[model samples]
Target: MASVNEESVRKIIQYVGGKNNIKAGTHCVTRLRLVLDDESKVDKENLDKVDLVKGFFSANGQFQVVIGQGTVDKVYDVFIRLTGLGEATKQEVKDVAAEKGNWLQRGIKVLADIFIPILPAIVTAGLLMGINNILANPGIFFKNQSIVQVYPQWDGFANIIFVIANAAFTFLPVLIGWSAVRRFGGSPLLGIVLGLILVHPDLQNAYGLAQARSEGTVPVWNLFGLEVEKVGYQGQVLPVLFASYVLAKIDVFLRRHVPDNFQLLVVGPVALLVTGFLAFLFIGPVTMILANWITEGLVGLFDIAPIIGGAVYGFLYSILVITGMHHLFLAVDLQLIGSTNSTFLWPILALCNIAQGTAAFAIFFVARQAKMKGLALTSSISAWLGVTEPAIFGVNLRYRYPFFASIISAGIGGAFISVLGVKATSIGIGGLPGILSIIPQYWGAFAIGMAIVLVLPFLLTWVFSKFSKKKTEAELQ
Candidate 1:
């Protein structure tokens, strides 16, 4: 590991308007997140020029500087030392930054904070699902049968792989519960227990309840004369999030009021009982309904006009990325894949990512400065690998026109893919490698759509760059 760079940390503080300007600071996997007292004081141009700073953006009221993976911690250490503020946890920093947002923004930030920690697990599971899809695809290897079907002897092996791939999503509520309670400064074990209760074996599996509800055969439990649905919260995001928040509050309150001698035994049991009842009686049902509606609404709109929906989504997706709210769609994407076995949104997202990468590549050729060209090349590669923060903030957005050019190109490519009905069977990455997640039947369409995304943005940005250069020269003459 590299040691903390004190000089770089000093420049970061100065460029961000000094330690006094930052109310709170913390680092995540790849960025330094700071709640700034005055946004106007930030010297973005100078900040970007700082050594080791990849890019910067303000989202959800936090001024974020991208430090890349692994290096963020070292920089964060120096930052804490320089600011004289004690080291803060990621959740604490999120809380401070969240304080500046309106109700909706704060709500989204809370979700992001809760989910971000567990994204690596979800993403890894998604990639494994993609691999499993290939293994199960009949057209890929065997003639008229999947690999598992063709080789009965290998069935057990395939099933084990499937279980490993499915574990994260199948018990997602537990992960969310654990993370959410910790974020709220409560006992994680109790949160995990609450999560287990939500997804107990005796309860009806959430996925199956959809079918059961349609058949009018869904089971119900009588809890103190109240009829409660016996549904497991498997793969659920919102319900567990709400339940954990309620649990944390109840736990904290009980500890404060309970006698010290009896606190250990009384607080845990009472908090769990009350929180569980509330979760089942109100919070779980309400949030699940909201999650279902949001999922159905997006699916419904896409069904209404696939091409238009794809175009609109691709055009606006980068904006969501800029605001750090893109994680909001992870649950929806997972749900769509879990229910329908495919998602149109993932294909469109792939094109949008490729389009941004292509725009950055064009900037590489057009840039007058060698340093700009190097940044463009590296950021473009990063974007192609499904990480677009570098390309968007470091290169394309910095150039202004390249950003718009990429958006337009992405919209057109997204519409093309939508018209072709390209659907991904899984959701792992979102660029060149993302094609691995697409259904085998739509692989050809995905390739063609990606080609258009790659070329069109490069051509459009290159042309715009030439015109801008000529105009500048003419103005000087």
Candidate 2:
């Protein structure tokens, strides 16, 4: 492998149009996300000339630079140092807004990018809670009751761990906002601040948690005497994210217009503080309410007819996976909004994720190019652990038909799940292990979902791959 150095990354950045054109710099398991000012600004041929840069692509309005595995981080570091901003550094928040895909698809991809990394943490916490429930009930496991009784202190420690673990999900909006602002070239701290406001104690009680934690008092927000009702903003994104972008733009404008002498003291602090409050009091809550309504409307469709719901969701889910927006669903799960508490998404997502990985693995088996084979296999392994970016972007997406096959398999299986009325009582991360989140009664359905996800894609790849081979052979001939 070519050694990644400052000059290489700088050249990569310059080829992609330099610091001014960059909105944000982020990395997945195998690639770097660059929110560019203009897709045309990126010179793909020049970028590929660099030994370290594997490839560059533009889809869904985001320009992605594939660096492969550990290289992404190094490249991201160089990009950040050259620009003086990082994914978590919100101060330089740039507008990452892109006009691509439908609003729903875009929204899903945004959610997935922010949430995928934290998924294992979310699942582990949920599972620990579930297991704790089982252990707490002595009668269910009387055969092992003695072990539990002897470990009373262990229970308290376990509870503490669960609470802390769950906190990551509870406060996900802040995490996402931080990253989002950085991507947009704004202040990540602003995002974090906005996130805190959403999940603030006062707001948490506004919707319902107050009653859960206190007396029968649900905190209500009185907006100009129009008593708008809502709950805590834990794990929310729309409000804070929207606010961050708005604030970033406003901040940039102020810094440019105001005199340098008084800008810091007068313009900087005031702009951020005032805009942030306006966002928290009005923008955040209002937008969240709107998102809730949209989600409810969609869920209502599912209630009205499961088949349409299943097909639409499955189809969209597959699309979202490729663009990286699926994490938005988890915020609902964490906050007990939408179908989050119902475990409906995991089985479908799991199958799709697994299908893509399996297809990529097959490519490794048959690929003529030694380098392509290596990338395919490395990505395949990561996909098994629920980190599908490597597989999706590095392998499957490169060979378009594999991605199509995965999407088709996901839809078929997801449709079957919807027909069976198969739903989970709890949410877990998506992957093979995510199968554990299935309620015991739905074990058969889970198995079927897995079968379709795993088997269908392999079959599709088998059928389609012959053409890939023939094409290669014909070219060689």
Candidate 3:
């Protein structure tokens, strides 16, 4: 509701050590996360004193300033206008900021950048799948028979729902290919075409290919005397990602060397043909093998010690969210569900989100300032609806102790879920609504786990706030 003007934007820029000091700037749901060339140039004391600034913190090499929800967009627009950094994408900002990190951090940043744009599609599909599961679940409404079985006429409708739910995941490579190529500064259309080639109708559907392979019924094509298995890329993340990267590099190289007159004709066809072969022959298989190995390793680890695994994952999950690297889990979780029909990770992740929300709610009750209380209440609701950034940046991270309390509480809940062997059949909206994603048989355990996540974090943070020195709204600045 707070409107930012040109003067306000100027003040913000001045307090952040002027436009020259800002390496890159971007906005998330409620914060303007900036990468500064020099952190010390940021007048934290004065910047915090700026009007409409809710809070400030540094995490994952980015200096983040909370500007509340809708207000951030207006402020970001003015900030960009004043700084003359016109219409920069979040991924572009991340790429600029990523210069400070080592190889691993940069690599993770790249993966997150590529995947974040496609998350809404995946999350939506997951939620749809959850709803379909509910409809089809015999244990729920249909007494020993699914909804379709009870009403044979509804089979076509169920089939339509299934297609709607799986469309994104079934063609996930196309999305990833587009995003990855764009990230690599290559042609997105070419990347999409390459993705289409990977999942061509002639190829065996990826989900069914495993069974077909076991039955020795998979078709193979002879390409230059090399026998190439015709397998589609479905619900695959890493293979497409790797293939896109190769495509991007090749495209860029071709663009640089190829004559301008022949660029359009030569660049696309050559790049696609070469990348297509490389993708199917080398990149796809190699990355898929690597992805499977990683998935299996994590599954094995969880199987070996589910409690410890869940606790550790639950604790670190939020930390990953803070670093903006949690999008990497989308692929992993999808792969897990594809192979196992369920994943132990999503249930724990749901608990972690609820824990953060509960901690924020505790802050709402205890905060002396009306503004902080309002922020806490609003952020808590957002967290409960499966978005945690507001709660994390606005309340938990600001007070510090509330965040640790959440991690502890979430870890406990995670351990409990692991002991019960509760798993999610789909990766849907998190928090309270996330229970829909859990396998019907584990709903009871999930509810209990959710209760622990809610109650323990609230109590811990509330008790801790009483003893810890309270920072007044003024002192918080």
Listing every candidate in turn, what is its Cα RMSD in Å to the true structure after a full C-alpha superposition?
3.4, 7.0, 2.8
- Candidate with the larger lDDT of 1 and 2: 1
Cα displacement (Å) at residue 399, model 3? 2.1
What local lDDT does model 3 show for residue 205? 82
Per residue, candidate 2 scores C-alpha lDDT tens digits across 93-123 of 2125444457776666555555554566667
- Candidate 2 local distance difference test against the native: 0.65
Query: What is residue 229's positional error in candidate 1, in angstroms?
Result: 3.2
Tell me how candidate 1 scores on lDDT: 0.82
lDDT, candidate 3, 230-254, per-residue tens: 8777777778888899899999999
Residue 232 accuracy (lDDT) in model 3: 78
User: Alpha-carbon error at 286 in model 1, in Å?
Assistant: 3.4
Query: How do the predictions measure up, each by TM-score?
Result: 0.87, 0.65, 0.90
Expressed as tens digits, the lDDT of each residue in 95-154 for candidate 1 is 887788788788777677677778788778778777777777787786778887887787
Q: How accurate is candidate 3 locally (lDDT)?
A: 0.83
Model 1 vs. true fold: TM: 0.87
Best by TM-score: 3
